[model samples]
Target: MAAHKIAHASYRGPSVVKEILYGISLGLLAGGLWKMHHWNNQRRTREFYDLLEKGEISVVVEEE
Candidate 1:
């Protein structure tokens, strides 16, 4: 008796439009995250400065 061989279909990679869309979406997500981080940092800095101005926070410096 002869052994039977199994054949499988090969997979085709993603199309150009799919790849382009993926790249665009990834770029947008990265930009959004960067913007969020920048906004948060600015907000925190502003609050810290406000606290300092209001005497709610103190800083000490010593001469060496």
Candidate 2:
């Protein structure tokens, strides 16, 4: 309708630069979090194996 055109005649959305920056920021945050999570899991696994080697932990297995 003509009313819809008149209402949005002067409306502007976000800039391209703003959109690019937002996307880059989001990507960096996600990548950093994923890296940290992977690093932590590796560290825990390493520590667990070291403890196991030192005989501080035990593993139980049963034969069927």
Winning candidate number (lDDT): 1
Q: What does each candidate score in C-alpha RMSD?
A: 3.6, 5.1
Which lDDT tens digits does candidate 1 get at residues 1-64? 9998889888898799999999999999999999999999999999999999998788876569
Please report how far candidate 2 places residue 27 from its true position, in Å. 0.6
| Pairs of residues clashing in candidate 1 | none
Q: How many residue pairs clash in each candidate?
A: 0, 0
User: Using alpha carbons, what is the TM-score of model 2?
Assistant: 0.72
**TM-scores of the models, in the order given:** 0.72, 0.72
lDDT value for model 2: 0.91
Model 2 lDDT tens row, 10-45: 658879999999999999999999999999999999
